[model samples]
Target: MIRLALVSNKLQKIQLKVFDSSTFSILRCWDPHLSSSRSSSQNLHDPTTHFHNEEALNPTELLNAQITSGELNEDKHQKMVVEELEKVHQNLQHYEPAKSTMFTRLFGRRDVMDSPKGIYLYGAVGGGKTMLMDLFYACCKMPRKRRVHFHSFMLDVHTRIHELKKTISRNQTSKPQPFDVIRPIAEDISNQSWLICFDEFQVTDIADAMILKRLFTELFSCGVVVIATSNRHPDDLYKNGLQRSNFVPFIKVLKDHCDVVSLDSGIDYRTRSSVGKDRIYFVKSETEADREMDKIFKMLCSMENDIIRPKTLTIRGRNVTFKKTCGQVIDTTFEELCARPLGASDYLQLSQAFHTIMIRDVPVLSLKLRSETRRFITLIDTLYDNRVRVVISAETPTKELFLSEGHDSGHDDHRMLMDDLNITAGSENASSNIFTGEEEIFAFDRTVSRLTEMQTEDYWKQWDKKR
Candidate 1:
């Protein structure tokens, strides 16, 4: 039992059970039973005999220490926790039971979708969106369901459409045999009562933007209960002239199908003032790009590259491949080539032939636009989908390879970037030797380590493991 304190991101206080170090990168650990009630805690084992016993950390240091320790993801599990805590914080007299409102038509009819009595969590960034969803996920006791990110969720949808296309394409004469777990999963997903929870539910770009209706419409008609945490207001989603109007009917559909609620009651979770020493991701210059490339390559080299089975999968075409593995790849359109569906025979047929993927003409990571920028997203999608831990990149310094829509000279880009770097660096797990005799179920994620540093094209061959 590890009693955790991430003073960063609004000085949060949460508890978690640290099962083991086999797959986790726990930075700070403490036995819940032995935790001191006294606010001042110290590392007595430190060689330096001195300690800063400050009384109550300022918001900045609280945020910094929490940020530097890499615990922001855990923070997402607190929306409901905070709501539960808010009751305690206010010191209320009694518990208010959730009221019934089927007839009111807040979203839909009573007993709709067979009334599975599931949860629906929604909120803004740092507004305790994921926190509530994760808490419910941990506490819920139900058989048959799946939790996934919106990106991976869409990938599964793409894979499904792709596979359905294949299943029909084969035109098999035999009756559907004993239900294969994977075959009926797509159809089964609709029949069962699924408590789907999505984090960071913002729609971006043309690809994902187009399919919003068909995807969720299928899910809703099939009976999937969604609990989502988002940074945008439901109506305000897909902001700007991003062709969101095409998704308007789906927005109405979402509002009609789900119990929409707001959780904007407290402080911004990202605004914790106590975090100490801000960390910044470097933007590389043309002259020093070579040095940056080495830094990124070393990060990948210090990792374990291995195969992993995807938890949620799509059986596309006759191909036996699954579209999602680590389930991080998100796209609005155009399925990644590696994620193309495969049937049993189709998979066997393409084994040695589809071995190596050749991503041609990858661009340098920098402010300048590169031809391969779109391909980078595809590369990331395939790597994440196939669970390919070992990625041979011709591109160097990830930032250079994935060029951002360069600064518009307005809006707090610098500050927002600092916040993004601070948040991502704060959210990741540290790399240790994560490989042993035990078969690895998850990817080693050399991509993140490389992505953390500046990517340079000068040493492209260095990223290849074969050399």
Candidate 2:
């Protein structure tokens, strides 16, 4: 019996040593039994260990370290936001997820522990909201956590809802009810992630707007905490959107669950250091632009041994063809990319396939090209989120790409739709809910901000590292 006990103790020690050497060390630190007895500094000598001490995981500490290292400039606004995020990071360290009991499940009661209030950080374009949020998300040690672009999250939500409805249709044994799938979908998301960080949170689509209230209500009830950064305030979201009255309650829910913070420091940080530093964006005559793009393309292609050829990407059973591709680089035109009917999903596929994209002949956009403008916005958003590099040849400078003065003729189709729905100009909600080019104009500011940032050396370096 003494020999058996000795062997058992030896095996347990070996198992612990293995865990401490691997990435699982972080998780082991969260274990109550292990954490109670172990000092955080005990693993400091081992360089393989991720965090040296509990303070190492603090978002504020990390932010200040970056500032000290000159990787980031000291900004009072950014400092304040990180201080708030530090509180959240500390709270999550001690958070224990409440488990559902059989009695609670049977009675449809959620027995959930109170979670820390999430944050909603809003500011003007080019502010450091995303940068701070990213710092916080990286420092969070929770295993059940997710960081996603808001548009991508909504797309996933819509896809899941569709699949769920299809499954219900195929299941013959289940009795048909009202067919509401939001609660179940929310539960699935909550099970996957207890903390969700969203970048660029906005609501423009009516389909998404209508479901926000129920979805978030269920998520909050399930103790799923949310942290989001946006240009618009919660009340300003879905402004002038169709059936926006129904979406207002979601704003209330969001405000009730989150402490809203404004990070407008009167400084556009992204534009301060990097504008016009990179020579990728060329504003010249068509012929001159073409020559410049061809020269750059050839230079890039020479680095790869693969022959230049046309590439086709199949997304959702649809084929999207690019005329020129060399290995992971694609040379396409603005007309070919934005003139066609493409969306977030299509752009996402392109971003995945290409490390660098060269776009030529991007003309000054007006309301007449509203569809193309919207597509361009989606493409930029997806590419930026994925850290994909973009080179552009445009008719005007980046700041002048989108013209603000144009007749609202592009929204005639919207007006016709409203007329068909018996929502006339005289209707009480027509002024607020009518679709127009103004929303596009408002969104173009963000697109312009991103485009300017894309031209910076730091942005290119980041993309190269990601590639």
Candidate 3:
């Protein structure tokens, strides 16, 4: 009997619930009969076990069994990805042995050459693609492993190669080998049947898309298994667009590498966010939220004189930094600066980082639609695009605020985001987050705005004299 189980975190308690056949309705999840961990807290030491079926032998327990019995290599090649990483599994499954030749074995091959094995999984947004990749990762528990978000992993690659190129330019070194730096990591995976998982594997930005061929090709040669989940379909990747043809070979490489399994679960998992009634927390006081902003004010004020590294700022006590911020421009690599660089995981860090962002009165520029203005527009666009839950205290609402007037220009960067990823902004239906009878379009906005205005005023006042 084939069975699928779901493990979800509800009320901060991670529960492993079982589903019935046919409709997959909840059959049994929280059974008092199964008490691995005595306490309600999600314990790290709890027995993590899941039976393959009615058979008593649980896959997870089997893993644990191997761990204790001095068999470190016990089924590390196969793992059950916790539900959180289902999307990753989908991507890893992209390589299956059946539909693939020896060359097409990247995503589709069964791990061993001796057996009949191949599987692929592909899908759209919030459909638990990463979850599956993670499952593949968990199964292959080789000690030498790496799992990175696509952007950060690319940024690191770019950084290393850039340093090496600089050495070549200096003529101090005859030839700098960038491969030496990242190869050891790759070799670790190649040593055995290794696993590599990349989250949010989409390439629209020129900086990343341009280098995909070389970077991945290098890793591919080193025998590292490449598994990635993307918003783009393989053939249509970066299709019919600027400098997009350069990415064609990359698409081919990916196609040749992994068997494309279009899971297309046809069901969006994101809608289940409101599955059970969660909390609608309200501010303790009208100004309580403001005080929280003050905490941030104190930090920034303290650092005003310091020409700190752009990648070393802390937000709400979490180490936060920007990727490309420098000289007359705040060119940021939010991907690199993000807490974990793994998509939705970073959003939580961001929500906790800043309560209020105050942009004191700078001249309301009636500027033209230049690159700088466009980039700034892109910055804000990206911010809201991610549904950053913050109190935005601006002179005007986002649509009108900071917008240069009469700029009839359109930008590809802004429009590049697809509708699937643009999950509509969180609702303001007066729950605790919006205590004002659904009156507040945004619960966190007003308080954030008020505090931000005050802070921005203070910031300008303190520095204006020098300017």
Candidate 4:
């Protein structure tokens, strides 16, 4: 049988208890300390207080300012989403969360007031979902607020759950009541932040899919608001996967808690300009591309005063070796970066260690290389979010890197995934839609869009500023 295992051994050591398959129920109990905490607005500096003559603008006004300044093209759909976010921004000014302790939530009457509904913006790639959300997050005056990539956030969640399990296991003196760790974890998060903004929110892994309902149910109950951007709608999340029926309840929870908005303007802003600018992306033959990359690497190394040698990174107690390094730059290949089992944490560490990344020999992605494709997408997302500079040499143009054909239908990766899902060949569940390259096809649009944007003159200007 093909097995789909957890990537981390720490996660594998702790067995997560299966949750009930009924409609998700919110946890009503609250920590007294969190409920009695001071409002974040009191501690933070309001932008309005900075200038006596001008007040802070809401998300709508900020978006209009960008359009008027020619930073962004005007689109009515984007305006609609911004207006909705503005409402939440205005509501939070005078909003008060209901107070509840475990005692009152269980026995006595509890104070209850409605909180503002969060937002989930979904649409096509490069439709300005992230841009608009950033505007909202920037204008939000909440001191206890955090904005992060969704993949990085989930990585942290898994790590926290593993660490929590280890702590609970070491306490030999306490009697174990029916322990559900997600509750305490949610309470801890609520104590830290009242608002969370997530970019590129998605659910693909079974581990993440299973825990979201319980985790979000508790987070929502603690009165933590979320604003997220994604390419998929709530109902379309985790469309098909192993035991997906059990994961369906999260869709309802998300829809009930967040106002779903679509911001598709039918134009991909990232790809409006042509590629091959700034001499960043090389599309020549493999040998020629390698030569060009070497020249660039040496030039970058000459500019830096540090010594040139190999470097090793220690991540999560694991050592990863990169053969080429010169100061704040590293020269690596797609095989070393994406073809192996590296993940978001690994890429996050690499991005932190290096300012400029030179990657050579990126092969044309197909269904046979679905795992590599997924990893590549994650790597680019992490780098792009961090604003790290990337120089790439690929087998084809950036837009044509991922092929749409399905000639490798019976590949081992496809068959293994089907077997792991307990789907037999020729079965209804094993239809073309299940193990096909649909997700990769949809995700490559984003990868290509980001790659195109990374080559723009403006992107290079940002890189220069960082240097």
Tens digit per residue, CA lDDT, model 2, 5-53: 2335565475455432322232222122333343321110121133345
Candidate of highest lDDT: 2
lDDT against the true structure, per candidate, is 0.37, 0.76, 0.37, 0.74
Candidate 4 total steric clashes: 0
* Cα lDDT of model 1 by residue, 9-79, tens digit: 33222212322231111111111222234222211111011213534332233323434554333343343
Please write out the lDDT profile of model 3 over residues 214-326, one tens digit for every residue.
65664566545566666556775544433566777887767665656654554443332222111111132323434433333333322233232453455335565554222
TM per candidate comes to 0.42, 0.84, 0.43, 0.82
Q: Which of 1 and 4 is the better model by TM-score?
A: 4
The order of the candidates by lDDT, greatest first, is 2, 4, 3, 1
Candidate 1, residue 295: Cα displacement in angstroms equals 6.4
Cα lDDT over the full model 1: 0.37
